[model samples]
Structure formats: structure tokens, C-alpha cells
Target: MLSEQKCEACSIDAVALNKGERDTLLLELSDWHIIEREGIPQLEKVYKFKNYKQAWAFSNKVSELAEDEFHHPSILLEWGKVTVTWWSHSIKGLHKNDFICASSCDGFVENE
Candidate 1:
């Protein structure tokens, strides 16, 4: 599945994946949604926690993961929910790395 894949260092010349490509990887992410924000395609998921502390902890874990992969996502940490939006900024669209990261986040929750 996509979770087993790793994020690659994307280049400015990297082209965004086509609809078929995005849909294929997106199938592995059960809770994630395809979105268009400011005309850029992205993958977003909301993770629910028991409390703020748990939510914050998850955010830290995601931060570490992002650092390790050298890819970052837009994260919104709330009282009991954390919204993570993933996209490839360098490519200005969706890339395999984004789905890889999103899958990794889902795997992180499974491990929790």
C-alpha cells in the first residue's frame, strides 16, 4: 500500500500526478479526502483524540515525521481533533510523496 512507500525529494520540475495516479494511491487512505484549496489539489484527513493532550502529542509525532521525510503538511490542532492537509508545494500540486506522507500518518494512528 501507499503507507509502505517513502517520500522522495521532489524537484521543481516534477510534474503532478494525473487523476488515475492520485486515485490509485488515494484508495489506500480510508479517511482522507481530495480537496482543492486556492486551486491546488490536496489530501486532507481529520484525526480525533480523546483530549487536547492527545491531540497535541499526535501533532508532535507528525512534526517529527514531517522532518524525517523533509515534507511538511498544514496541520490544525484543536481540542480533540487534528486536521492534516498534505500536498506537494514544490510541484504546486499532488505528488506521490503527498500520498505517501498521508498514508504514513494513517499508519501512525494504527500504531497508536
Candidate 2:
């Protein structure tokens, strides 16, 4: 359902999701987890691949998707894995947009 949604422009005054909302939305994302970096909560997931080429390709796909959605994530491409962390930088916390993007990321692998 989240993958079916599109990200909206987040404003500086936009409120982040509360704990209950985070938990409920997280249920739709099985591989993603919430983590705190410098006290800011983020949704993170590491997708594994066979090699650097596969990982790089996957990261590029995610990048294009983020560009289209206008909601970017911090993506780390490694030898055989890519780590993606999504958070609302303006609000400095997790947002529904993060969950939507995370679900979209999963759809990439599923469709592969």
C-alpha cells in the first residue's frame, strides 16, 4: 500500500510521525528498522547483492526513484550491499514519506 503512495513535499513545519504511527507504518516494511543517528530517528535497510556491480545498480535505481519522488535518502553502496537511510531532514525525524520510499525500495527487488 505504501508503495502505491507518492511522497509529498515536506515543509519545515511538517510534523514527524509519532511513536504509534511509526510502529504501525513499520509493519508494512518487514526489512526496514528504525535507528537513531545523532539523536535523529531514521528508517534504515541494507539490501544484499551478489557483488559490487549488482549493489551499484540497485543503488542507482534507488537514486532515480528518490529523484522522481523528490524525497532522497542517504545511500551507502558497498561491495555487496547497499544501506539506505531515510528520514525527514527538515523535521529531523521519521516521516510517512520515509516509509513510502522504503516500501518503494522493496518493490524494486521484488520486481527483479
The most accurate candidate by TM-score is 2
Q: Report, for every candidate in turn, its global Cα lDDT versus the true structure.
A: 0.89, 0.93
Residue 94 displacement in candidate 1 (angstroms): 0.6
Q: State the local distance difference test value for candidate 1.
A: 0.89
For model 1, the stretches where C-alpha displacement exceeds 4 angstroms are none
| Model 2 segments more than 4 A misplaced | none
TM-score of each: 0.95, 0.96
lDDT of 2 by residue, 21-108 (tens): 9999999997799999999999999999999999999999999999998888999999999999999988999999999999999998
- Positional deviation of 104 in candidate 1, in angstroms? 0.8
| lDDT string, candidate 1, 1-112, tens digits | 7867888888758999988988888888787999999999999999999999999999998999999999999999999999999998887789999988888888778998
lDDT of 2: 0.93
What's the CA error at residue 111 for candidate 2, in Å?
A: 0.8
In model 2, the Cα lDDT at residue 108 comes to: 86
